[model samples]
Structures are given as structure tokens and as C-alpha cells.
Target chain A: MLEKAIKGSKLYWGWIGLLLLGVATGFFAYTFQMKEGLSITGMSRDVSWGFYIAQFTFLVGVAASAVMMVIPKYLHHYQTFGRVLILGEFLAVAAVSMCLLFIVVDLGQPQRMLNVLLHPTPRSILFWDMIVLNGYLFLNILIGWVTLQAERKGVEPPKWIKPFIYLSIPWAVSIHTVTAFLYCGLPGRGFWLTAILAPRFLASAFASGPAFLILLCYIVKIFAKWDPGKEAIQSLAKIVTYAIITNLFFLSLEIFTVGYSQIPSHLLHFKYLFFGLEGHATYAPWMWVSVVAGLLAVLILLFPQNRKSDNVLAMACVLVFLSTWIDKGMGMISGGFVPNPLEEVVEYIPTKLELLITLGVYAAGFLILTILYKVAVGVKKEVDA
Target chain B: MRANRRKFLKIAGLATLGWSVFPNLLRASEGGEGAGHVRWGLAIDTKKLNDEVMEKAIVACHKNHNVPHIPDKREIKWLWKTTFHKAFPGQMLDNMHISEYAEKETLVLCNHCDNPPCVRVCPTKATFKRADGITMMDFHRCIGCRYCMAACPFGARSFNFYDPKKFLKSEEITTQFPTRTKGVVEKCLLCYERLDEGKKPYCVEAAEGVIYFGNLNDPESEIRKVLAERYAIKRKPELGTFPSVYYLI
Candidate 1:
């Protein structure tokens, strides 16, 4: 066992040590937040949501993006996807785990989380959010485990797993769409009060999430000496390019509506988010950066020459991922509350506890991804690919 | 100690679910134990709002209820004022130009909507509508999601940012209720506890009849009579929230 462990030295102990460090730091940070309340974080009344939730929202899309591999490999009988399908499933486990962790840290009282279960309100979008999040997590775990068991036994996957794999395609859409609904269904916050938000969420998720997975494929090639095939990478790049175009289109639709209507309440929110309304310029820089990065990513992916280059493709993927991470994950929710209910501009900065806890959560995700990918790589090496 | 702890837990648990599920059940179970049957509602005469009596009513309710005035102005609001035009955009007064009085009148607390959007959006069922048509927020169960604040159309909710006691005077602190911690949203409950004590709302009593407290359900009630007799209006009536609170123009 020790020899086996030594053989995969980079994947085993190094990954474990990183996870332990993250868990330890997160424990301390969570304890502090619990002792001092949410005030220990940078969130205020106007900006109630921040980094943790943004990360949660972004990661859910990444988790759902696993469907890209599952759909093609199983449904379409794409032989190319067979070699790397495990990577997507494992990445999903990591992403979903982090999504849950973000929600926990974002809660004012993490201990009382069961209150959601004890007193469920069907009328509330939040109640459904909990349901969808948990359901998605369980679905991924079940499918991933069943498929892996088949791989281990050198037998065909179970009959039931096919239905579930099929169900998860639309279910994957629902998880992120429901998340967008949690914001869009709100009555007064004009920032998210639109019919288009759900579609927008799916578009951006497809853009950034597949980009992340493709990057993971490249990373595996570099570190683990496994190639996910250039064809798969190119196909993913095509999906991302189209998704980015749609994502940008929806954002433009929002801008046009706000500008055309010229309603003070609606426009003020967009103004504050994009260009700094009434001297509230904190998020303005981030918004502009997101715009530039997003546009550049789309252009890079669309241009065959750019997408063909590994470095350029990797850079484009990183930029698009972060842009959506900022735009939808952080800025969308937070910007709604600025020029608050009372029309006053208030700033939100995450506290040290929040920052540390967020770092720990990211570390936890990295640890999971690293370990899972190792197992997947090892399993694949044994196969006659 | 164990028994007391158990009892407290039971009560707290029941209270948490009660307001969300069956608020009216308590009134029926408790056998209407007040000064006769009362379906409480408030009537504000904005013209009289500037009167010292009305201001005293606001202050009286604030003091009796231990409502904190956290000096960080953005976070501070239990009772305050706003122009009619500012509060309701589309509604037009008959004599807009000549009557400068309409501009100066102080708009008090939430209208206490019969169909509250705040209650609809709360994830933990922390803010629920009482059977008596009062929208009350339970600070203990609130997860500080702020979805309630986002859902409220009237902009009545205020979140406590810093510890409220830091900004309040010692005398301002009352034993009847605990001051809120940072995070959870809070707003006026229309002195429901005071109404339970066989007394008019502190606001009404202090206002010396400037603020009328009565059963809006009963046609013979003071508020109903006032609504019928005077030209009265509710804020943002178009939204169809059907607020029990009425203001005499």
C-alpha cells in the first residue's frame, strides 16, 4: 500500500495536506463568524450577499457542466468522451461540495440551517433553492458512483443509470435556473426582476462552466499526461463561444431596456453597478473589467487561430470564467441592494473572517478535485485505451 | 432547570411556527382575553402628523417598545416621515400646487399589508403575517437572508448593522423587548403587545386622538367610521396590497 501510495506521490499526500490545511483554517474562520455574527463579514444591509454566495452560484454552474460529458458519452455514444468522462464527474463532486460550503458560510446562523426543513414554505423561492441544491448534489453522487462501480467491475453501467443521466441534462439546467429564479422572483429589486435572468444564467453557465472543464482537461494533459483529445477541446471551445455570445446579448438587452425606459429606480441600480451612480464607484471597475474580459473571451474563442493555441485558449477560459464569476455570482445579487430600499448607497466589504473562510472553501474544492482526478487518472491508466 | 429549558424550547418552537402557519389559532385558543374583541388597525391624519401630539405618539411607541435609533442614519428607522409624493408616485392630490401641507406631512411605519410580500419571500419563515393582519418579524429565527427586505414593496424594513445599543440612550432601552443584533431586518409591529394589554396603542394614546386606533374589520369601529366620514387614502393602493392603515387627506 505504501509503495502504491509512493507511486502516486504528487496526487496522494500532497492533496491530503492541502485539504487538511483548508479544513483547519475554515474551522477557525467559521467559529469566529458564529461568535461575532455576520458582522464579522464585509456584508451590510445594502450588500447582504458577497463572495461566498457568488462562489456558490458560479460553482453550481460548473457542477452542472458535467452534463456536457455525460450527455455525449452515454447518449450519443461518443467514443472520444469515454477516456475523460470520469474527470467531469469528479470535478462535479468537488464543485457541488463547494457550492454547499458557500451556502453554509453565507448563512447568518449555520447551526440553524435545519429551520429550513422544520418550517418549509413552498411559496418561498428559498425553500425550493434548498431542494434543488440538495437534489442536484445527490443526483451527481449517485450517477458518478454507479458509473464508477461499473468501470471497476469492467461491466456495463446499470440500466437505471441511463434514465438518471438523461434526467440530469434538464435537471442540470434547473439547478442553475432555479438559482436565478431565487433572485428574479423578487418583486421590488429591479436589478434581477426580469423574465430573461433564467436564460441568461444558463447561457453564462454554459459559457464559463464548459470553459472551466476544458481548462481542467488541458491541466490533466500537463500534470497527469492524459490527453482528453483535441477534438473534445475544440468542440467545448465552440460551445463556449456560442454561450458567450448569448450571455453578452442578454446583458445588452438589460442595458437597452433600462436606458430606453429611463426609470430612475431601475436605471439607478444599473448605473451604480456599471458606471458609478452618485459617486458610488466601488463596483464600477469590476464591472468594466468583466465587460472587457467577457468580450475578449468571446472574440478569442470565435477566432479559430486564437482558440487553436493552448495558451490563448487557457487564458480566454480563465478570463470568461472570472468575468461571469464576478458578473452573475457577485455583482448581480449585490448590485440590486445598492441604492437600497431607501435609495441610499451603501458599501459592502467582506471581513477578514469572511475572506479567510472563502479561501478555505476554495482550498477544500481544490483538494477534492485533485484527489478525485488522481483516482480517475489511475483508473484510466489501467484501461486499454 | 431541565423542565424549564424544555418548556422554553417548546414555546419558542411553537412561536416560530405559530406566526407563519396559524396566527389566528392563538387568538381563538386564548379566548379573546383582552378588553373585548379587537381587530386592530391604524389611521394617520398626515395634516395632524406635524402636531406635537402626533410626534409624541411616535416617540411614545418608540420608547414603550424599546425601538433602537442606531445613529448610522441608513440603519435607523422605526418611525419617520416622508412626503406623500415621495411615498406614492402615481397618486395625485386634488389640490397639488396650493396645498404645501401635503409635502411636509410625515409618513409613519409600514401600512401592514394584508398580503405581505415580505412574508412571502422569507426563507426561514422568520417574517410572517399574523391572523390579525399584522406583519411581525421574528428576529430569533431570521437567517439574515435579506430577501424579505428585497421583497417588501413599501421599503419599510431596516436591517440592524452595528449593535443597536451602542447608539441608543440608556433610558431609550426598555425591558419589554431585546434590541436587535446586526444582520436581521426589523420594522414596526404596530404595538401588537400593547394592544393586547387592554390599552390603545402607545402612539394613539400619546397622540391624544390625533392617531386613531380601532378595528378595521368592524364597520362600527372608529377607524371604519373615520374612513367612511373623511376623504382618506392608503399608500400605493394600485399595488393591491390592501393595507389596513388609512390616512385622512
Candidate 2:
């Protein structure tokens, strides 16, 4: 598996090199942040969490979305999704690893991070988030590797792995739900106080996770000269279609509840995100882009004709991915902070240092994705040969 | 795929059962530090809390705790004065006439809730409530996640974004309360250091009969005495934090 990534086309090697460069740059910025404390980033007392935490939230959904493929294949006995399940599992392994990194970098005292484990408080949602995320990562790595080894050997995967696979389905849902509790359980932050938050997180996760997988299959097809089969892609597109539509539907529910009730504390974040709050409408434009992208993604996927065409389907998948990224990664966390506890409106704009660090994290995730996909493809190609 | 649905069901059920049961085992381990003491609380008489009196009290607390006077963007506070409109938004107004309270500011500090949300949400037991109903922060254990800052409804907590001593006078870093390092949350500990020495809180000592601190559990204590006689209110009482502090408006 490692050897497969070692041998690659010039483009593949170039991409890996670029990602390494990104990781190095981000590591440098991280050192500066560590030296000076969080003041080096754009965060303040009001906006305590910024780019790092938002990315952590978004990637947790992406990590959880690995189940969309797993559920259809293992539960419903969909043969098409079985071919692509390896891809989803690997994507999750990468996403969860990235999610962990985001948590590490976001800490004010990285050295003291072990304190969470040293003094575990299960009452704290964060304690549970740690438990579930690491558990999911280990589960995916074990299942994905064992199953692939069995495929290479032309034998059925071991019986022990089957129970773990079934366990992962619920485990996936728990990872995102526990992450939602991190925000929803907090008493004062009105923007995240809704009962729908966990469901909304799952809905958006189901959309973005599978949507990224659809794009990834094509990337595998083009670069590695391996096709997961059109049936697999089409099946994934359908999953993304429903998830995106349901995600948008959930967003509308939030809009209705927050807008109609007109409670200033509850309404303020939405207004600040969609409109402006006391002249600080920095995120309004980005929030609107996400809105339009979400609606357009839903419309494109609903049509069976567009769903069949690779170009339109790819476009729709990208649209869903982008919009979900902005909605969760940018707007949701920032919105919760604006009109902070004191009813004071303060906007968060990520510093270059923060953005560079974030870019480094994404690059690292991709590097893992590339290698994992390479290994999966190598094993499949060897089996065919 | 030769999958037995029943076998899968058993495995899935057991795994789910394991996850649900494990956290409770850990949660049951959590308990307050140093049991068996009366709960401490504050009773503030707003009638005696003028702008000058509040300023004097704030300065005294800062001097005692070595709180930094940082720039507004990076400001940190433990005890401060805010207008009644800001502190008690959408409360006690419409039918009731606007008394002198509408214009005058109210003194505020950590409510040190009987159920502090900050303590509940902190990933580490860095922030925990003492058995005496005092909320305590162990700066050494804090990872600076700032979840406590978000969980606290009163805006009582502050993060040391910069080392607090940077803005403090050289002499202000006193032996009374240890200066907190950067990247840890800090707030009024109800002068826990002074309480240990049997001395009154700096704010209580500075005020003349305006600030009262005593055991809430003891009916004979000053805070309980004030609560018995005066019409008092705690900030956001409807939220049910059970704030140990009270205000006699």
C-alpha cells in the first residue's frame, strides 16, 4: 500500500510535493502562534473560536458522511456502493485525522491538551467527542485495511470485521451528534441552541461527505485509470441529492424559527450572517454565496437528466461541497459568536497566519487521501491482473 | 455478502450499550472538591453603589488579584459595573414605573452559580465548583479551549489572551493572588485566597455596607440576613443557574 503511493505519475508526485510544502508552511505559522498565544490569530475574547474550530466542525461531518456508502452497501445490500465503500472509508480516515489536527491547533495551550484525557469529564461533550472520533478513525482503518487485504487475496473478509462494520454505521452518526452537543449544549449561544442542530449536522454531513466522494470517484478514474463503475457514482449522486435537499430544508426550518420568533439574541446571528449587525456584515456576502450554491445544488440534483450527465453531476457535487463548506466551516460558528454574550457585535476575519494553517491542514488531508486512494487502486488493479 | 442480520443486531446492540454505559462510569467519578462547608454568596445593595463606589470596588479587586488593564480589544475583567439595561435586559420594566434603578449602573461579577455552566462544560476539570459553592479555576490544568467562556451566560469569564502582567504595574503583581499566565481563563474566585486567610474580599472591604459576603446556608450570616429582609434579584434567575450572588435593588 505504501509502495503504491511511492510510484506515481509526474502530476501525482507534484501534488504530493505541493501538499508537503503546505504542511511545512502551516507548521511554521503554528510555531509562531504557540509562542505568542492565540493573539497571533484573528480570534479575540468575543470570538473565542475562529477558523480552526469551524474547520473542525465541518470536517467532523465529512468524516461522518463515510456512512452514506457504508449503510447502503452493508445494510441494504447495494452491490454498486460496495465498489466505492473503500473510497468512503479512506476519506473518513483522512477527514477524522484532519479533524483531530484542527482540535490540536485550535487549543490555546497545545502542551496541556493531554489534560482533557488526564482529567476526563464525560459530562463535557468534548470528552465524548475525543472518544468517538478516535474510535471512528481506528474502526475505519481496521475495516478498510482488512477488507482490502481479503479482496487482494480473493477471499472473504474475516467474520470479526463484519461486526465492526455494522458497529461503524451507528458510530458514524454518534461522531457528528456528539460534535453537535459541543455547541448545542452550551446555554448562552442562541444560534446553536436549537434541538435541530444535531439533525442539521447529520443532514449537511450526509450531503457534503457523499458529494465529495462523487467528485473523488472521477478523480480516481482520471488519474489512476480505475473506474468504480458508473452505477456506483450514480448511486452516490442520489444519496448526495437527498442529503443536500434535506440539509437545505433544515436550514429553512432554522430561518423560520429564528426569523419568525424575532428574539433579538436568537435572531441577531442570522441577521449578522445574512444581513448585517450594527454595520459589521463581513460574512454576509459569503453566507449568500453558500445560500445560492445550496439552492442551485438542490435544483441540479433533483433532475434525473443532470444526475446522469457527469459534467452536470460533477458541477452539482462541487456546488454542494462548496456551499456546505461555507455554511458549516465559516458561517455557523462565526454567527454564534457575533452579538456575543454581551450583545456586542464583533466580526471575525481570519488572519493570513490562520488561513495558512488551515490550508496546511487541508493539504495534509489531501495527501492522505491521495496515498490511500493509490493503495486501494493498486490492490484492485493487482486483483484484476 | 453472507451477512446474518441477527448476529449483526447483537453486535450492534452491545456496542451501542457499551458506549452509553462507559461515559456514565466516568461521569459518576466527577465530584466537587473538599466537601462539607456552607455555601458562600453575595448581597449587593445597589442604592449604595454609586459610580465612584463601584470604581473604588473594581480598583480594589484589581489590586488584590493583579488583573491587567489591557487595551479594549484585549480587555480582561473580573468585577465591573454595567448599566441595568445591559445586565437585566427585557426584565422588570413595562408595567412597573422607571425608578432610579433604570439609569444607575449595577455591579457585576461571577454569579458562581450553584450550577455553573462553565464548570459543567469545561473539557478538563480545570474549572470546577468547590463544595462551598465557589466556582474555582485551576489555571495549570486549563487547555484554553474557551468553552467555559461560551457556556457562561453572565459574561463573567475572561481569557488571558496576553500575559496579564504585561499591562499591570510592576508592583501590582502581589503575593495575595498568583498572577495568571497567558492562554488560561480567569475570573473572580470570590477572593478564595483571602477567604483562606480569614480576611474579607477586597471589594467587600472597600465598600461601606454596600457589598455583603457571608455563608448563604447560615441564616445568621450577613448575606442570608440581607436576603431575608430585602427584595433581591440574581441576574438571569429564569435561566436557573441558582446564582450564589444577589442584588438588593
| Best by the lDDT measure | 2
Candidate 2 TM-score on chain B: 0.83
Model 2 error, position B87 (Å): 1.3
lDDT of 2 by residue, B177-242 (tens): 788888999899998887766777889888877899998888888788778999897888777789
Clashing pairs in 2: none
| CAPRI level of candidate 1 | acceptable
The regions of model 1 sitting more than 4 angstroms off are A1-7, A10-12, B1-30, B33-39, B51-55, B73-76, B82-86, B89-105, B160-173, B178-184, B229-233
Give candidate 1's iRMS in Å, 1 decimal: 2.7
List the candidates' TM-scores in order.
Answer: 0.87, 0.92
The DockQ-derived docking category for candidate 2 is medium
Model 2: CA > 4 A from native? B1-35, B92-96, B99-103
